[model samples]
Target: MEHLAELDKKHFIHPTSSIQQQQANGPKVIMEKGEGIYLTDINGSEYMDAMSSLWNVNIGHGQDELAEAAAEQMKQLAFSSAFSTFSHEPAIRLAEKIASIAPDGLNAVFFTSGGSESNDSAIKLTRHYWRIQDQPERRKIIGLKRAYHGVAAASTSATGIKEFQEMAGEMMTGFVHTETPYEKTADEAIHDLRQTIETEGPDTVAAVMAEPIQGAGGVLIPPDDYLRQVRALCDEYGILFIADEVITGFGRTGKMFGVENFSITPDLMTFAKGVTSGYLPLGGVIVSDHVHEMLKEKSKGTLFHGFTYSGHPTAAAVGLKNIEIIERDGLVENAREMGGQMLRAFEKVQSELDIVGDVRAKGLLGAVELVQDPATNKRFSPDQQAAPKVIDQLHERGMICRPVSFEGTDIICFAPPLIINREQVHTMVEKLHDAVFAVQKELQVKG
Candidate 1:
């Protein structure tokens, strides 16, 4: 373990992590094994996987079926690119399965390696569809503020998080951000969207992209009617709706996709993460029939956008098995039921702890907002590191959670595996309660 830690420090560069911290502390924890809602590190300390790793892992961890499926496919045919006219059965079946389960009209699939690539492809596909329709100028995309898209060029540009865009240095351009409906009225947010589009000129605006629930942006759920209004607005402007379901896809949101909760079918839905539960990296965009027909009939030779590992046979096979397990075991319903218990648990935490300013959940995806003054919802100063401190307390107590301390906010996010049971939900939230309580005492925040 020490040797591996040394090697990781010397050679490996972690994504979106502090290099200084990595150099100071060799490694936080080397995870060795995982089971339902539990992860055991190399030191043999077992902890609840409260954040589902990176908000994926809907099926939990160490599933034999997914491994067997991958092994079987690899032996038969490990890889064969989906480029040009060539394709394989695994890719075809997975795409078909996604279509059948997806919201209506999004029947066609274009593959990518993961969320970033999927979103990048979706942005390009939107433009490509418009270009083919002789609306080449309809290339602008409007994203919601605090929306977390992905890190690739176009995806980064589309992402509403200022930090991500700043990190990418110069944004790819043709993208604008509007205020999110989170923590506010939908009418005002919708008006902002409308105003932004009109200001950018309706014809130049190609699509409006967003996550059904802003996952990485602190699990901030919008008003119930927000997405519906956005859909109508998009339709009014003849603009495409791109749903980035990278984190909220599959059973994580108590539905196959996050948009289902809002009863909205986006024009193009980009998905990854839970499709294979992180067993392997696989993601894709599901396009509407109109978009599909446009590309099929009008597009010139070579649509010409895809990753080499796009539609990977092994990954696709695992995805099929993953969805099968989700269906057969009724994991989506499990997420819904367990998620209710978790939210109630969080509400209980908020009621009892003054530090817990707010709590919100959409299925397993949830967050507990920590604040300095609960009555005013006044946030703690940055130096306090309230969210990370609570997360550290959770870590010491044998549980893992994510901190959403971005942009002067202190939040602890949770997305336990869909397979998590009622007892596990109760226990995890109980631990979170204890952790927050401990942090409250440490920070000396008074009621």
Candidate 2:
């Protein structure tokens, strides 16, 4: 413990980590390695990586091939700037490969370092695109309530979760938020979105940004027709549609892209996280042909928007190889098949546990919602800290799962790697089942 504290104090300033918690309890220092869907700590304790290291490691952990690709790229030419008339082969090839897999009409790519950077770029580029098209007034960006876009100023503004905005002092002006489609019926949600647009004036609305499944927002899965309606509405209002697939890209949701899972295409799509299976940082925005042509024909001089590491050769090479592994290994198809099995496992929990409120799963992504009274669908009081307690119990049992912090409710999200099989799903479920019971016994004692 002393060793761990010394290391964190000297070298780490963690992201999204609670400083108070760290000060009190130190870190869960994971040294050693992982394979397929399991991680072993320094003490030789094994835990199924049920959250896929924050839902990113799609192809699984500790794959030697990814390391080989990185090493090979480093040996050849590790660094190349994509600035002004300079281009690298890996970057060019990655752009082409991404284009081949993107939805129809989305043929252009602009690279960034990660999801936050990609979102930041998208916000700037969307506004720039509209200005070039002579619609500068269309600057209002609409995001769904409970959405998790990113952490930067503009991206956080584009985000719908209030928790990310709590310390920011003020909300971004003209950044509108509406109820998510999952909160109501598809038509009702559409009606509410239309009302928001009407209230704000559609002429001022530049775009509607969304995730097909709200991955960080407690795995809120929209109705099957939600994306279709959203696409139609965006077209009706002439608002650019942006799908934030940072968490759902690269077969996390059993599809190459989460938007593809719903069969709806967007005007712009932002991707990161699973692109290189979290082996390297790479993110980008895919633009539709109309937006692409407009930016090309109207914008003079490089669009004035890019990063120093845009399409970094090393990241691009890793992504190319990662996509190859996914294709060669058939991980996407496996996710679809195993996801069904995992969802079925939830039925046993629902049948046995009185605390279960709802079970939602897709591909390798899922969440089990806990309520005080499952019969009446009444939620547990937020002060009870039920979800965190369950997380602690699961941790003690040597499994790593994340508690969904949105809506102040108890939701345990599960996102194993796409490579996880039925046996691994069973292992995770068994561990979770025991943890849930342990929490229940404690809560009963407290009551």
Candidate 3:
């Protein structure tokens, strides 16, 4: 453990981590193995993977089927470039599978290496689509506040998180952010969206991207009609809607995709993470039939944007097998059931504890907002670090989860593997209860 920690600190810069923290504490936990809904550290300490390792492992930690698929494909043909009209069977078959299962009208795909690349591709492709339609002025891409797309240049610019953009110095032009429906009523939110569109000049806008449910933004769930209204508004203005489903796709949201929960068909949808359950990095933008047709019919030479790993044979094979497992085992339905059970568990804990402000869950994704006083909705000071304290307690108790303290809100987030069962749900909640209780006692003493 010490050897690995020293190497990690000296040579590796972890993604989305505090470098100083790594220097101070080394690696938080050196994971040695993973299976079902749990992971084991190098020292043999087991932990329930409550956050699914950044909410991507929808099917769970270790699945033999995906490994076998990758191996079998690699033995036959490890890779073949899908560039300049070159193609391969794995890419073709996976694209067909994605088209068959994606939301209606989204029947075409352009592959990428992962969510960041997928989102970046979607932005470029949307602008290209408009360019083909002879609207060269349509280049602006608007994303929702608190929405997380990816870490690539375009995706980073499209993200609503201030820290992400600030870290990148100055962001690129043509990216705008608007308030989310979580902060406003559905009607008001739609009005705000329409106003943003009008202000941006509808003729100059290429697409408006959003996460159906804000996952990293504290699991903020909008009203039932919020997305539907947004879809209608976009249609009314002749602008494209892009659902950034990197976290919510592939049965994580109790459906094949998150947009289905709202019954809306985005012009373009970007996905990754659970697409292959993190076994292999693969992601793509599923284009609508009309958009695909227009690009096919009117596009000029070379659509041009692509990744070297795009349509990688092994990753594509693993993605196919991953989807097979998700369907065959009925993990999507399990996420729905387990999600409700988890929500009820959260509510029960909230009822008994005033510090738990609000509990929101959709499918296996959920969050518990921490408050100082629920009746008044008063928040604990930032110095208290209430959510992180509770999360640390959970970690000490052999459960892994995330604490979200974005924009003055303290939230504990969870997105357990879809394979999690009722007993596991109860166990997670029990540990969470104890964790929150322990933290509250510490805070009381400190106060």
Candidate 4:
């Protein structure tokens, strides 16, 4: 184990991690196994996976069903290119199954390796659709501020987070961003979208892409009618609406898709993460019939956008089994019930802890905002590093979650496995409360 840790430190380049910290501390916990909502590290210490391993793993872990499905497909037909009229049953079946469960009219599927590729494909498809319609100038894509798309060129440009865009140098042009609907009524937020569109010239705009609920942007849940209003506006202006469901799809939000929570249909929907419960890499975009038919009738030649592993049979087989388990175990219903329990528990913590500034939740997706002054919602100074400190305390307490510090505020977010039970929810909240209290005590001492 020590030798492996040394090798990881020497050779591995981890994503979204601090290189200095990795070189200094090496790997903190080497996870060995996972079951249900708990993970066992190499040292045999157990931790409640409160963040669901980057907000995927909806069906928990250590399920032999998904493994068996993958092995079965591998033995029969593992590798095949989903290109130039070549097709496979697993891909065909999975696409049909996804369309059956997707929001109305989004009946066509385009597979990708993961969320980033799915989003990137959506961008290219949107632009291609416009070009085919003879409106080649309609190339601009608009996104909500604080929104996370992906790391690809087009996806990064569509992302509203400035840090990501800056990391990649000058982003691809023709992408703009508008204000998020946080703390605003639906009408007010819709007005902001309209203003951006009017300012950008609707003729030049191609699509308005947004998450039904912004996950990485601190679990921001907009007003109830926010998406509906946005859909209406996009329709009115002939702009396509793309719902990035990478984090919210497949029962994470207590619904089949996040858009169902708002009863709005998107022209294009990008999904990943929970499709195979993180057991396998798989993602795709569900194209609305409107867009699909347009491509069918107007396209001159072939659609040139796709990934090599777009329709990997092994991954598709696992996705099929994952969906079956989610349905058979009634995990979606459990997410709704347990999510409510988690929110109520968070509210109780907020009432008890002055450091807890706000608590917001939707289904299993939730966040606990920490602040220096609850009375005025004043955030902790960046130098304090309050969020990471609290998260460190949580790790010591055997609960794993994410510390989100975006837009100058610190928040600890949770997205436990959908199979999590009431008792586990209570335990998670108890540990979170203790962690926050520990941070608060440290702050008081420093003062």
Consecutive 10-residue window with the lowest summed lDDT within model 2 = 22-31
Candidate 3: tens digits of C-alpha lDDT, residues 82-197: 98989999999999999999987888889999999999999999999998888999999988899888878999999999988999676689999988977578888788788999
lDDT of 2 by residue, 213-249 (tens): 9988899999999889989999998899999989988
C-alpha TM-scores of all predictions? 0.98, 0.97, 0.98, 0.98
Task: Give per-residue CA lDDT, model 4, range 308-396, as digits (tens).
Answer: 99999999999999999998999889899999999999999999997899898999999999999999988888889999999999999
Candidate number with greatest lDDT: 4
Whole-model lDDT for model 2 versus the true structure?
Answer: 0.88
Q: Candidate 2, after superposition: displacement of residue 127 in Å?
A: 0.5
Candidate 4 ranges beyond 4 A from true positions: none
The Cα error of candidate 3 at residue 216, in Å, is 1.2
> Model 1 has how many clashing residue pairs?
0
RMSD of each: 1.2, 1.3, 0.9, 1.0
Q: What is the lDDT of residue 367 in candidate 2?
A: 91
How many residue pairs collide in each prediction? 0, 0, 0, 0
Task: Report the error of model 1 at residue 381, Å.
Answer: 1.0
lDDT of 4: 0.92
